[model samples]
Target: MGGRFGSPLFGASIKGFLNDRSALEGITSFGSFGIGITGLYEYHLYLPGVPGLRPFLGGGAHVATGRASAYNPYADSQFSDIYAGLDGVTGVEYVFEDIPLALSIDVLPVLNFPGRIGLWWNAGVSVRYVFK
Candidate 1:
C-alpha cells in the first residue's frame, strides 16, 4: 500500500513493502516474505541552473515483521524479528513537462532496534503522477 502526496517538487509517501525474506537478509537459504509499512517526509531542492532536475532528502520510520538471523557462539538460527526503526533517504528526480510523471531514484538506509539491530539499504526507483 503506497501513495504519493503533494507537488512534484515536494512530496510525502505512505507505503509498505512486501519483500523476499531471503533477499532482505542477504542470504539465499532463507525462504519466506516480509511485510512492512513506511512513512516518509521529503523535500526537493530544485536547481534553477539546471531545469527539470531536483535532489531530495528525507527521513522516516519503518515497522515490519520478518525473519532475521540471530547468531550465538554455539549456534545460529533464524528468528522472527521486528523492524522498528528510522531510515534516511536521498534521491534525485526529474519531472517530465509533457507528461504528469516524475521519475526518481532513491537510496534508503535503515537502522533497526529491539529486534534486528543492524543497518540495511533499500535502493530503488519510483514513478509518481502529479495531480497539479
Candidate 2:
C-alpha cells in the first residue's frame, strides 16, 4: 500500500497486464476521510535498451461512500455523501530483473463529479511485488 501526497489516505493497488502495452489496476484506499476504491486502465510505453522501464498513461473512475475533505465546502471538514469521480494517471515504472519487484511514481489527478469539477493533484509512489 502507498500513501497520497495531499491527504492521509493509504491505498493498496494491484495491476495486471493484458498485453505488452496495456494493463489494468484496481485500488482500495482508507484514511480519516473514509474508504474508496478506484479502477484504471494503463498503457505502457517502452524505452529502447531499457528493458524493464516504461512510462504509462491511463484513465479511470472511482466510487466512494463516506466523508471526504477535498474541495468540498459543503461541510466544515468533509462532505457526508457518496462521491463518484473521474481520474487520470501518468507515471514511470521499473521492474527489477533479479528480484520480483516493481517500483513506480505517479501523479493521479481527480475530478469529482457533481462536486469538484476541477482536477486536484494526487501524487504518490508505490512498490509492487511481482508474482511470476
Off by over 4 Å in 1: 1-32, 69-79
For model 2, what is the alpha-carbon lDDT of residue 46? 95
RMSD to native for every prediction?
Answer: 11.0, 2.8
Error of 2 at 84 (Å): 0.6
Q: Stretches of candidate 2 above 4 Å error?
A: 1-8, 68-79
- Expressed as tens digits, the lDDT of each residue in 1-132 for candidate 2 is 333333445678788899889999888877666677889999999999999999999999988766645533222335566677899999998999999888888888888766545555667777888887
Best by TM-score: 2
**Which 10 consecutive positions of candidate 2 have the poorest summed lDDT?**
68-77
- The per-model lDDT (C-alpha) reads 0.53, 0.76
- In model 1, state the lDDT of residue 115: 41
Error of 1 at 91 (Å): 0.6
TM-score of 2: 0.84
The pairs that clash in candidate 2 are none
